[model samples]
Target: MPAVTADTLTLPRIAPPAPAAQQRPVRSVTTAPSGYEGEGFPVRRAFAGVSTADLDPFIHMDQMGEVEYAPGEPKGTPWHPHRGFETVTYIIDGIFEHQDSHGGGGEITDGDTQWMTAGSGILHIEKPPEHLVVSGGLFHGIQLWVNLPSANKFNPPRYQDIRGRQASLLSSDDGGALLRVIAGEVGEHKGPGSTFTPITLVHATISPGAQLRVPWRPDFNALAYVLAGNATVGTEARPVRKGQLALFGPGDALTLAAGTSQPAAEPNLEVLLLGGRPIREPVVQYGPFVMNTREEIMQALKDFQSGSFGVIPGERIPHT
Candidate 1:
C-alpha cells in the first residue's frame, strides 16, 4: 500500500451477465407437413394446418422437391400471376430459373435466393434449368409467401436476387454455429435482401451442442422452420425435428441449440427463422393472388387476363 503502482495492483475479472434471464422463453407449437401436388412436382407444405391469421405477414411456406427427378422428369411451376404479396425462394440444391413478365429473368443455383415483390401484379415462371430437366439430379428448395401491408399492396413490382455469399454471415463464439441473414440483421451484420415490411429472415446451421442466440424485435411475430436435423429452441428448450415448423411466443431474443437435451447421434441443425411485424389488415387470397379484399382479387385476375400483368419473353399468346 506504500505506492499504488500499476504492477502492484491486481485486476479482478468480472464475468459477463447471464443471458437466459433476459432472453425470451421459447414456446413451441409443432405443425406437421401435409403432402400436396404442385404444378409438376410434389411438395410437402408445413404451413397448411396453420392459419395465416396465426402466422400474420407470412401467408404460406412450401418445401419443394427433395425428390429425385429422373431424366426428362424435372418440372416446375408454370406461368402464374401474383399480387399484393412477395415470394421468397431459397435454393438448397440443384438449379431453378425464374422469368418474370417484366423481363427480369435469372437462374438461382444452390444456396441462391430470389425475392420477388408482386405488388400490383406480375406473371412469372419458376422451373428447373434446361440442363437439369434433361440430366435431372436432385432438386430441392423452399418458397415462402410474405403478405404486404394494405398501404404497400399496390406498389410497383420489383425483384431482389442474392447469391450464396452475398448474405450476411455470423458465426458463434466457438465457431460451431453459423447464421446467414437473408432479410434481417444479426448483431451488426445486415442481410442482402430488401424488405418492405418490418421482418427478419435468417438461415442458421448449428453443429451438435452449439447454441445460437438470435435477437428479435419484441413486436414481431416469430417462428422457426427446421429444414434438416434437430434443434432445441427457446428457454424452455422445446425439441423440434426436421420437416417441422415451430412457432414461438413473445420474447426479445430466441435461444436455439442443436440436437436434443440428451446427447445421441445428432446431426447438424439447419433452420430458417422468420419474423415480421403483424399486419392486422384483411387478407383475401385467390389462387396465386393475395389481396386485402375479394374485389381486389377479382381485379388482379382481370388484369392478368387483359395482358397487363406483363408477359414472358418469347411466350406465345394462345388463340381462343
Candidate 2:
C-alpha cells in the first residue's frame, strides 16, 4: 500500500509485498541479528529482537518471555526437542497449551499466531494454561527462530495456526494508517503470512501527524521495531524511540513521523517488522542449544549427555 501525499514522510525499498496464501515464495532479505536477551518472571523483554551474534542460522528471538508464577511458582516450559528450525509464536496476551512431540496441540491468545516447523525432529511444550493457571496481567508475546536451508534441512515436522481472522489489516479505508499483517503481503490487502521462511511480518499504526509509506522488497532484509509512542525508521532521519531498533538499507522505505516526546493522547503507535531469506548457515551455541558446526556444537553437548536431547520437560531448568 504505497500512495500518500499529506504531512510529508515516506519510505520505499521494499519489494516482497505481493505473494500471500499459505506463503512459500522467495528471493532474499537478511537481518536476523538478535544476540539474545531474556527476562522472564517479572521480566518481559526477551532479546529485544536480537542482533545476531550467537544463534546464527536464526535460532532465537523472544520479544516477551514472562513466566511469573509466584504463588506456588513452579512455572513451566519444558519437554523440548528441535532440529534444523523454525518456531514462532505471537500471542499478545495470555493463554497456552501449545503441546508438541509433533502431534501438535494449540491455543494462543489475544492476537494469536503460532508456526512451528521443527523440521527433522520435534517435541515441544508451553505451559500456563490450565484455565489460566494463575494468570498475570501482561504475559504478552513474541517468539521467533528460523533456519532450515540446508536444502530444507531435513524437512519433516510442521505446524501453523495463525488466527486473528487469518491476518491482514492495513487500514486507511479512511481511518489513518494501521497495518497488522503478520506475514508478507502489504499491498492489495491480501495477507495471511505463512512462512517456512522468506518471511515478513508487519504491525504498524500511524496517526496523530500520520505518515505511513510502505512499498519494497528490493532485496528483503529490513528492520523496524518501535512498539510504542515514538517513530522514525530508516532513510536516516533518526529517532526510533520506544525501545529503539531500526536497521534499514535496501532502497529504504518506512518513514514515520510525530515525535518530540510524542504525546497527543498517545495516538496508538506500535511497530514490528521482520525479514526472511537468509540461511547463511554455520553456527553453534551452548545455551538453549543451537547447532551447525563446531563439531555440530560438540554433538549438541554429546547429544545432551547421551540421553539425546530429551528430558527437559518440567523440572530440570538447568542448562544456564
Candidate 3:
C-alpha cells in the first residue's frame, strides 16, 4: 500500500464570494424525508437501505432515516458497485466495518471516520461487526453522496480511515464552539479526511450565546444541518435547529450563535456543515444505483444483471 500522506485536509483560504457568487453557495436545502423505518434496530441494506434524499450536487443524504442493527441481527449490506461519484459514511453514535474491492477495510466507531472514493468503479460493502452487533447495542449513522468532478469520474477507487481521537479539534478559547474537522478545516483545525473533491464537512458544537465565525468557500455550495440545538447562519441570522437544514446563499462567512441554550444551562448545539461545487450532472438512480445519463444508468443495470461489475467485497473468502 502506498504510504498515507497528510491524511488531515484543511480548507483553502475563503476568497470573497464574487458578485455573481455573492449568492448563497448552497444550491438547495432538503430534508431526508424518511428512511426504511425498520424496527428498533438490526438491519442490512444497500445505499438504498435507508430513506435517502438528494440536495442537488449532493446526490443523496440518508441522515436519521438511516437504520441501525440491534445486537446480533442480520445487519450487513451485501455487495454493491458505485460509479461516477463518491460515498462518505459518518457515524455519530455507532460502529462500522467497511470493506471495498480496492483492498481496503477498517472499523469506525464513535468519533472515528471513514471515507470511500468510488472512482471509475469498485464493489463495496459495509456493516457493523457481528460480535459488536450481536453483543453490541444499536447501530446508527449518516451516509452522504458526493458527485465527482468530470475529470476524476473514472479514477481508481480509494479509502481513508480517520480515528476520532486523531482528529484535530478547532474550538474557540472563550467557550464559543467546537469545530470537529471530519473532512475539511474550519477556522484553523484541519480534519482527517482525504478526497479529490472540493468539500468541507464539520461537526460543529456551539455553546449558549456563543457565536463563532467560519470562513466560507465562495465558489463551493454550503449548508448546515442542525443535529442538536439552535443557531443562525449567514447575515440574515436565520435560525437553525435540530432536524432542520439551513441552506446558505452567497455569503463570505457563516455565523453560528446559540439561542436559549435549552436545559442544563447549556444545551448541546451541533450541526454538520457540508457543501461543494455543484456537479450539475443528470442523476438517474434506483436502489443502490446512481448514474449520470439515463443511458449510462441502463448500462449499469445491464452490468449488475450480468455480474460484470465484479464480485462481492468478501465473496472470495470461501467460507468452510
Candidate 4:
C-alpha cells in the first residue's frame, strides 16, 4: 500500500439534506459483546463465534477500552499477520500508532480512523504511542474486520488513514443529530475510505427527542451498534443501550430516536450504523486469515512462515 501524503488526502463535502419521512419501520435483534482480553488490553467482542454467521462481510467487531491505563501499564497487539480481509479501526480517544510490513503506518487519535486492506498478506503492529504509554490516560476505540469477496482476497495490500476533521459530517435539518461518514454514502455525504464491497459505515449522535431517518440501499443488510446512551431504533422503536448490537430488518431507511433521559455515560446517544451487500460466499477463517476455503487459509499460513508476507522495516523476528 502506498503511503497517504498531504497531496493525496482529499476530503469530500456534501450538502446536508432534509430529514426523510419515516418510510419503513426499523426492527432490532439485540446482542451483547462477550468479554475477552486481547494482547494486553481488554476488549468486548461484539461479533464472533455464534454471531459470525449472521454478520456476513463483517466477521468481527471489537470495542476496545473506555478503560484508563496507569503509566507504564498500557499494552497493545504486537507483530501479527493478516490476509484475505480488511481491518477498520476507529479511534474515539487517546492515540494509537501502527507500523506494517508494507511500510504503511501512522498515528490515529481521537475521532480518526484507519482502514487496512490485508489483501495478499502483511505483518503489522499497533499500540499506544510511546509517549502515551509513559503518560497513561483513557483509551477507547473500535476495530472491525470486513471480509473480502473471494475474487479480491489475494489482491495487493493497501491502507487509508482518515483524520477526524477529514471525515464528511452531515447534520440533521432540525439540528438534532450529527453523523460522521467513515465509509460509503449517507444522504449526500460520502466517507473518505474506499471499500471493496458496497457498504455504509457511520458514527451518529442524536440529541434527546431528535429523530434521524437515513436512506440506505434496500439490498444491504443493516445493523446498529450502540456505543453510548439509549436510543429507540427502527419502525418497531425497540430500545437499545450501550454495548448492544442491534440488527435491523429489511428496510429502505433507518429510523432512530434518542431518549429524553440523560444517558449514563455521554450526553448524547451514539451509535455505529453499518450495512453491506452480502457476498454470499462460503467463509473459511483461521486466526487473522479470512478466505473462502480451508486450502486458501493454508496457503496464507505458508506464505507468512516463508517470509513472503512482505518485510517490516527493522523487524528481526522470523517465523518458527
Clashes of each: 0, 18, 11, 3
List model 4 lDDT by residue over 222-310, tens digit each: 88888888888876788888887777666577778888985556777888899998888999989999999899988989999999998
**Which digits, one per residue and each the tens of the lDDT, describe model 2 over residues 1-320?**
11111321232222332333122112212233333232123323433445553223355555553334444432446566676677888766665557675456667776778888766556677665543555443465667676766666457777887776566655543345666677776554545756666667776666655555665554456566565677654434566555455655444244555454455545556667665555666656555445566776566556556664334344321110
Best by lDDT: 4
Per-residue C-alpha lDDT of model 3 across residues 1-320, encoded as one tens digit per residue: 00111212242332333444343433333443443522333322222322223345676665532334445663556667787777887777666677777776677766666788877677887766666766756455667777776677667888887777666666544546666677766545567788677678877666678776667666666677766667766656676665667666665566666775554622767677886766666667765556666787777678767776556654333211
- The positional error of residue 39 in candidate 4, measured at the CA in angstroms, is 2.1
Task: Estimate the overall C-alpha local distance difference test score of candidate 3.
Answer: 0.62
TM-score of each: 0.87, 0.32, 0.77, 0.89
Residue-level error in angstroms, candidate 4, position 12: 12
> Highest TM-score, which number?
4
Worst 10 residues of 3 by lDDT: 1-10
Model 2 lDDT-worst window of ten: 1-10
Please report how far candidate 1 places residue 284 from its true position, in Å: 1.0
Question: In terms of lDDT, which candidate is stronger, 1 or 2?
Answer: 1
In candidate 1, which residue pairs clash?
none
**Global lDDT scores for all candidate models:** 0.77, 0.56, 0.62, 0.79
Candidates 1 and 4 compared: the better one by lDDT is 4
